[model samples]
Target: MAITIELDDAMASQLRSEAAARQMSLEEFGRRLLAEAMHRIQVSSNWRARNQRRVELIRKSTSAELTAAEQAELDDLQAELYERMETADQDLLDRIADLENTVMP
Candidate 1:
């Protein structure tokens, strides 16, 4: 699908500069960014589903002991969730810095 959208001059210039820095055309860079964003959305959805299962497992544990496999799965899920949170936190921080640089500089 092809879509056309208007961007302010500053935004357009910034994107062009970034694309140049990566040695890619603006269109290619934009496509790559969109693909990355879609991947992130899918990852977030998967995380939500895993979180729900984690909650269910914890609730079950409170009522009765989990089997060995269930316990291991819970541990793995917790670690994966923590890693995702850390990565997300870092991404937010990086975006904030980028925005600050754009606005203040």
Candidate 2:
């Protein structure tokens, strides 16, 4: 598919410089960057969906005694959820720092 995007001169120059530094054509660099971003977005969405289901199960278990297997599954999911949340918090802080550098005086 062919699409036309209008980037301001500053952004276009920055992108061109980055592509040149990487020894990649602008199209290839843009494609790789976009593909990586999309993959991250999809992974984040899947993680949220899985975590939501786990949260629901945990909540339900609060109302009744979970079987041994269910309890084990919940324990594993909770650990993973905590780890992911920590990573996400760090990512957010990093992004905030980047934005501050870019836009702050």
Candidate 1 lDDT score relative to the true structure: 0.95
Candidate 1 residue lDDT tens string, 6-47: 999999999999999999999999999889999989988998
Residue 92's C-alpha lDDT in candidate 2? 100
Name the 10 consecutive residues with the lowest summed lDDT in model 2. 49-58
lDDT at residue 24 of model 1 (Cα atoms): 100
User: Worst 10-residue stretch by lDDT in candidate 1?
Assistant: 76-85
Q: Name the top TM-score candidate.
A: 1
Can you give the lDDT of residue 7 in candidate 2? 92
TM-score of each candidate structure, all chains considered together: 0.74, 0.68
lDDT of 2 by residue, 1-105 (tens): 977788999999998999999999999998998899999999889988878878878898989888898788888888988998899899999999999999994
